[model samples]
Target: MIEASLPALNRRRFLWGAGAGAVTAAALLPGAARADGHAETVGAVMDGMVRDHNFQGVVALGRGGRIRTARAVGMAQIAQGIPMRTDTPLGIASISKRLTAVAVMRLVEQGALSLDARITTWLPDYRADVGARLTLRRLLSNSSGAPNPFRAAVAAEPALLQPPWIDTGEAVRRFATGDLVFEPGARFDYVLSNWILVLAIIETVTGQPYREAMRALVLDPLRMRHTTPVAPSEAMSYRTVSPPVEWINPRPPFLAAAGGYYSTAADLLRFAHGVYDTDFLSPTSRTALTTVEVASDSYALGGRMRTVAIGGAEVRAAWETGNTNGYRSVLGHRLDGRGAVVILNNNAISQRTMDAFAEALLRADAGVA
Candidate 1:
């Protein structure tokens, strides 16, 4: 449930370099008194969520590089009675897209890829007509007209949801290749095929498997030691909190670049710091990452960038959310250096409530009324 006191954010503007883009690491860190207050605010809201929604996972609020509040509520594996911990890794779902986008940008910075070039430059095997029209920027921004065939197919044949592992090339050919649902870059559609094709491009460009390329480009550099493309033995998702019926959501190798990965709250926070607080990305790439390309979706490259008004103060941030099976996650990183909010859950709850919770934490951390 959402906090009644916290006002819903009004996303009125898309401001780049207004928050995280201009701030230094030293300025983003909070003082001791502020950190204490932030912890109190987070704890109170988290306690309420656990009591009301049966939230089962970890929630962490951090500023600069230090964690102000990190709590684990409910159980990771209900059948085994394994309690959740702040370090417990949980499936991050589409948050993996943000990581994949970053990896692709790194390649662009290295002169290995171009954002405006037609996808066919790298994916010659793709359908010529469609590939010639789609570009890396359009795909990253979810403006690629790629149709979501997997969704319909999975609904008709549940078995198709998680088949045996397939290589990136095969996955792209079977699932990603499709007719354009709309003119490329004419509108927005959050299709999984875009990232699937992106995975194939990454593999072809780097001459490495998706996981290996991700490790070399992103995970290893960020020191996200606990994050992995392969699903780890961590939390077990539940459809219901009282009886805790298991929800099976498998992550095959081909889906790694889309919505397939497990991560801890701490590791996710580390990623926020690496991306926003440090010089991990080049200036051009960093700017490109947060520049709003799709205004209707509030999307930049792989994530949403918008201005949130909290307590009469407008805060610019990168808001990334994921929900699949019974797992849900949110990563809110304030570009203004106030901090970040990371929530990972095993039991499916209202996404609106989760988003509100994260925003409330941000408001409290910023001490905005």
Candidate 2:
């Protein structure tokens, strides 16, 4: 239910950092909030996991409101031999969706738009008719019926990996004026165009570009210093990097509102804390962020998940996945905020493994593991 084609990014030179880890028994456990508790064991466990998967990147664990453990495995820039570290920046693909959703909700809170109102009321430049009836709610919940934008772009332009000289603008254009595969609120298609449009709404109502508005509304508020949108000219794109094992080259800026943000595991944990704690939005907006507006097994605002297997058991948890360029990430937290996990990878091999890790953490917190 979660498969999608990835975009291309030119493999370039990169930098790396030292690795560290935290063990289950370390003093750095979430309860202690001490950075010293589990660093060694966590580093070893994560490094072993990375080697086992033949994946390169960094992994960090944040629990009890502090970064208890962080480790970078493999070289960040193979050419330069840079090791991964807790502060190493990595692209977080779809995880960007949650931030975008938060930006849109901020607008909703400001009365710039209504979730139930037709999006056409906000975006008059688009060419779709059903769009006139599509609501911000439908788009946020994946109920908007636009088909996947990359497929159409690939259909028109074969080499989508290169510079946007042709493919980039065309892809955004096809989506900007594309047909709706299903009426708003009919069924779930998990297309990439929905949040792109939501971004347009944020820009329209707030009179700021999506990147700037996102920074102001989400990142800045959460103090996510390492997180930023992927722009075409960003130096990170040219930094030689490893390939993601599961998925590859999920474009950053091209898929901006849907996917396309970078951050460290520490940064993501802070973002999760803000989401669960509502440090950025009001009480009403916070309720709206987690409200299950759609019927999918997993998918909310920018995150996706209904249930997860943890500690040899199924647990209810909300989560998000990201894959782009040479980076991948996972962010999940229990609704109660007692448990949350962030895994950022330079390759795609960590999704399932991170899920297992998250489950274990949940079990430990739930006293079931």
Please give each candidate's TM-score. Answer: 0.88, 0.78
**Candidate 2 TM-score to native:** 0.78
lDDT score for candidate 1 against the true structure: 0.79
| Regions of candidate 1 where Cα sits further than 4 Å from its true position | 1-37, 155-157
lDDT of 1 by residue, 33-116 (tens): 555555466556666676666666777778775565666666778777676776778988889999999999999999999999
lDDT of 2 at 55: 44
**Position 267, candidate 2: lDDT:** 77
Q: Using TM-score as the measure, which candidate wins?
A: 1
Extract clashing residue pairs from model 1: 19-335, 19-336, 20-335, 20-336
lDDT of 1 at 137: 94
Best model number under lDDT: 1
Model 2: residue 215 alpha-carbon error in angstroms: 1.2
Every model: Cα RMSD to truth: 7.8, 7.4
Q: In model 1, state the lDDT of residue 73.
A: 63
lDDT of 2 at 12: 24
